[model samples]
Target chain A: MKKKFNLPVRQLATVGAFALFLLLGNFLMAKKIIGLYYTKVLMVAAINMILAVSLNIATGFLGQLPLGSAGFMAVGAYTSAIIMRKVTFVSPALAFPVCIIIGGLAAALCGFIIGLPALRLKGDYIAIITLGFAEIIRIVILNIDSALGITLTYGASNLKNIPKTTTFTNAFIWVFIVCYLVSALMKSRHGRAILSIRDNEIAAESCGINLTYYKTMAFIVYAFFTGIGGALYAGYLGILNPSGFSFAKSIDILVMVVLGGMGSMTGSVISAAVLTIVPEILHAFSDYRMIVYSLLLIVVMIFRPAGLMGNKEFSMDMLTGLFKKKAKGERSKK
Target chain B: MSTFSLIIKQIINGLQLGSIFALVAVGYSMVYGIIRLLNFAHCDIIMVGAYIAWFFMTNFANMPIIAVVASILGCTLLGVTIEKVAYKPLRSSPRISLLITAIGISYLLENTAQLVLGAAAKKVPGFFTAETIRIGQVTVSTASLVTIAVLAVSMVLLTLLVQKTKLGRAMRAVSEDAETAQLMGTNINGTISFTFAVGSALAGIGSVLYCCAYPQVSPTMGSMLGLKAFVAAVLGGIGSIPGAMIGGFMIGLTEVFVSAIGLSTWKDAVVFLILIIILLVKPSGILGKTVSEKV
Candidate 1:
């Protein structure tokens, strides 16, 4: 009875903390204590964190490399942007959330269709097939305007004039939800089956986990979040170009997942923030920075193959442990 | 121009493009057969080879032959060095790690090239004489004929090398089972290096041909070309030589035909669509063996 009473208190406190962070951040931006430029960077970082975390579900937990994430993002982005364009009758507050949902659903549907045939192949073949699918999507989007003889996407010209409804507060709320749902899922029985599949596919199959169902579930979930992230990106930018979603962009998100410990959500968030911020700060050494970044990736893989956190999440215990003399022991061992 | 001549001209263009793709795809197939790596950096080797050839030919201006040889040698050396430095220590690690390392290397090369050479596309002077061979309305360049001829020679030589050589036996044995091959006294490191050497050399040849056909060298030229060649390799059943050649030609023709029929913008889309269809129908590809996994 005491533990049950504590649970609600703890949940209320967490909600209070989230609310505090959101309001504080907004106040700082309003007063210009935090510049608009930095605010934009923070929002971009939040979106990237969402992308990295979503991709981790498949690449880290499910153990598949589908390189068409940018394509799914494109689907979500264009869908949401187009829907928002059509629904000028509704209030911005009412229409924004609905558009994001529709965008995510569209991408989720795409993920299901593509996942069926693409997942039949294993490892490198799956990677290549997904890449093919991404390329096809990009090309279709690029040529669709001319093919249809209409201005649906505006094709290479870029879709513009969508209202910028994704603020920092709203974006972080979505990020919080995505992170929470992923953690909750991974803690459930279904998440155990997904983890089992990643650990050993053949063994998981023998154990009566329907391989296709779980694999598709991971993919669908991944697609939905990616779409939500993309929807935010479209709203933030106020423009949507097919060129924005490319193979290189997919690799950029993958780099974040790799730089972080793939199986760890906190690692994805921290690395995503650092990567987004650092690049913006080092705008002068742009070309040389990429050289350094690639070298970092290589050296990191060689020296610490599992990544910075090595599949471990950061927790309060970790911080408290550092204060204790027992900190000499690797906390990862637990 | 009549319709028949335009079609014939397009066929010739396809053949020339296809031959270059075949050379690169063979390289991809050979390396993948042994290491099971996509070898993402292989494409950058082609770009480097083009740059090296451009450097030599521009400085020397008289001996195009020396430029070709240097490009090939540079590619081979670079390929071997990358394998030794980046890949060697990770042999026992997970495949995903190896894959990530490959991606890092690819980015490294492309970025370094961009930093050093700048991102502007360089126009390569015609290595061959600007002479055209024409019969009726189909006019083909001398370079196109040379590319086709070189492809035929390379295929025959490569087929003979893989089928009849001692190194070939070692390669076959290793790809089949590395531990067994080592137990049977094959030098695993040497065999892998040799595979990289030959594959990079093919990429070098492809670079020279690509420069001839496209007549431009840029830092990112290899990526698009490499991606297509990789697609061809997969379409042909990755590890098979004949399959790579056939897949390259098929891809080249399909691209040409798609564009020729007035869907020029949809060429890339059509190519990927075909790959998806074929992969779905036959997961192992047209000529790939469907090896059942053993628990």
Candidate 2:
């Protein structure tokens, strides 16, 4: 009877934490503590957080360096933006979330197509191929409207007047949901298998873990969120340009993941926020910002290649251990 | 011009473009061969070379040959410095880290250029006198002919340097197994630095040729050019010398043909598409050995 009453402790705790977060978020927004400028900044930060965490799934966990997250994002952004524009019957609020999901699916499809052939190769080949895919995506988007004789993406001129359905609250909710889902996936049996593959591909194969299936799965999931982030980005900006989703954008996301610690979800989230905010804070130093970013990347890789968090994750165990140690110290002093 | 003359002109243009790509691609291939790094910054050596040449031409002398030599020396120094300062410490780290550091170095070079020189594109002074040669039916640009001549001469010189020189043997040994090379009393650092120097010198000459053809220099100019050259390197099987040259010409020809077919806007896409197809269909690339990894 006691064992039955024990319940799923972790799940219960997660739900409670989520509820608390919503309450706190509501209070902050209601009180206007996070001003308009901060809200906009936070929204961008949240989108980056989603991108970084999702990219972590591939580069951090699966140990594959995919340089095409922006390509997937562009696909999603265009898909969602077009859907929102064309589907006049549906309400903007309802259509927005649905469009984001559809956009994610579109990106996932692209990921499946690109990943099949790309993941077959190892190391830098995957990087270059993925990079090629990204450039192709950007170029196609840039030239597709001209070729097709339609204003789908408006070509290089870009799409203007996208319905602004993405708000701070909605973006925040999505970021939390994505972070939760990714972390949950990372903790599952499938996550362990993925980690094993990263640790040693040959060993993982010998142990009967299917490489192709898992690699594609990771790529697909990563692409899905990248697409969602893109859809949200489109709504936030109220415009879309192929140039906005270039190889530079992909590198920016990569920098976040690399800075945060590839294997740590929390690290990615924190780094994403910091990186996004740092530029805005240092707006006066705009020209030097890229120089600083480049120097930081080189310095970090040289000194601490593992990144800020390394492979260690934040958990209740760490907190409890700290509290227990403090209590024991006090007790001993007494 | 007649259609046959037009075709000849396009082929000349392709050869000129191809020569630049081959020079840059050789640098990319050599670096990748030795360090197993993509060296994302390798292409920026061209930009650095171009700027150096431009400075020499505008501020000092309009002497093309001296500018070319000075730019080549400048790029060699920059490449060696980057290898020593940024990449050397992360040599034993993960390949991804090295790759990211290379990207960092690339960004650093580009941003520095943007800051110092401004972001606008500057016109490069013509290296050679504007002259045209007429055949029986077709006219050819002297610049294109000179580019091809320079490419041929450089290829011959580079081949001899790699095949016959003691330093070339050290580079080959380091590429094969650095640990073994070190055991055999090779100065590994010197060998790697030499490789960077030679590769960057080629990029320097490539910059001079590219500037002669296009006559424009910008902070971000190296990016697209570098990407194309890197694609050429990969298409030719990444680690092979002759493969890079062949791949460079193939890319150049493909781009010219694509534009000739009136898909000028899609030329970049087509180049990237070719890279994807080549990677998928033949990962080892043409002229490359299919060496499978063993546990």
Candidate 3:
């Protein structure tokens, strides 16, 4: 009778709310109700959200453990930063997006190269190989200038003078785009192929999914957006150095992905926000914070290994279902 | 020094480093073989061992024998306790959880050590006396000689223990199939605990040797060393004992050579590059078995 108050309208409503929230956040910043400190935290949370979600595609969906998110991020950051520095004629507005894309592409190229050979190995080996690659990437960035006799990358020293272009509005926008693409990817036929591979590699291969192709594809997508996140990270900080993208940095991102439920985009968003802010809130226990945080990780895995959200996503329907108690019936869909 | 002599010295240097890597890597390989975990805490155990040694050496003022025994025993106990407390419950869970838990434990050890010991490195002088034995064209430190000798003795003892003992057989059975081993009345828990003990003991020995070479103990020292040793484990073929040893030597020599060529800064990169290349060429590692997944 009411034309079935359907999917498209619900999608439109969610989209509108998302935009409205963004506008509210910007307005609050403008009004100084969200201070500079809080705004910085929000920006960092946005960056980490991009990192965790993009990492989930490769780690969560592809079921591969790669310790090289920071490597790709470093590549993207340096690539875009260097290019931005090189191009003097263009306006900041025009050059920023192009550089971000180029940075992403460069990182994707690295992922493809590393993943092609690395995906051949099984679980722990892939993790080790990726860690090696990340370390090598950092060292290369650290020494590329002095070894090759070029002024690029500036070696171990920090690369400075890049314009800061990552505003809160733009970074959160990128986060939404990355989350959308990743989720859409999971729902696509190809995403099915990727997930199936993760669920059981041999079964998928027997069913005729080219194991290498799908694996590398997911990894490339991961590296590409991680690169973009890194690019934004680059613009956010306006400086770059190999020291900034160490193995520990990659571990930090992994901690976020693992702390949030792997394979859950909404979980990544929540954990990223919570993790970024809570550390600041507990600033008094800065030294002991890692100890507590690590203990929390152990407890979470022991009691609930599925992480804070498990594999469940935070859907709009779930929110409505909480109010109406019909989400389960709706989710069954039969 | 002549070119030949310099090369000889570098070879000695490589072997010294290689011996330490092999010592550390044995722990990683053994743990991975039995438990199928990366055991990020294995490296941190070595760090704890170093600190214990530092504690003994600094507080007791030069009781090297007491320091060595206490450090090794401390690492062994810590390793077994970590397995009991942190990893036992997750034995049946997904491997990723175990891995994250291991990492969490590693962070716990490091941060605790940092908070307690302070982040700055406490320099502990070399355990070996500064005795240089010069042969026809080469001069060798007694520490290097002792390192290689200890590695050799440990490897022999380990191989013997794994090959000729009941516990070793139980370890092999559990690694092959835990359910089958338990069905056959193997004490799976005891065997796993024993494995952790042995591995941590190796880490303890490694830390002692490392303290000799580097003469310093810091909270973060073990992270990179542990990573390199794990790579060594992978390079030789994960889950293979001799593979770990060979991988360690290769990595050790690679680092020495890279540094020798005036690319000291790039040595870490070179070690990782060698690992990547080796894995690309031989996916299972030099001595690793190629396991095919059964559908």
Best by lDDT: 2
Candidate 2 DockQ, CA atoms: 0.82
For residues A130-240, write the lDDT of model 3, one tens digit per residue: 888888889899988898999999976799999888888888888888888888888899999998998888899999999999999999999999999999999889888
> Tens digits of per-residue lDDT for model 2 on A128-244?
778888889999999988898987889878798889999877898899889889988988988998999899999999999999999889889999999999999988988998889
TM-score of chain A of each: 0.93, 0.93, 0.94
Sorting all predicted structures by TM-score, with the top scorer first, yields 2, 3, 1
lDDT of 1 by residue, B93-138 (tens): 7777787788789889998999899999988777876668887668
lDDT of 2 by residue, B100-156 (tens): 899999999999999999999998777767678887898888889999899889889
- Every model's DockQ: 0.69, 0.82, 0.77
lDDT value, residue B8 of candidate 2 = 91
Cα RMSD for candidates in order: 2.9, 2.3, 2.8
* TM-score of model 1 vs. true structure: 0.96
C-alpha lDDT values of all predictions: 0.87, 0.89, 0.88
- Candidate 1 lDDT over A118-206, as tens digits, reads 87777676677777778888888888989989889999988999889988998999999999899889989999999999899999999
Mark the 10 consecutive residues where model 1 chain B has the least summed lDDT: B128-137
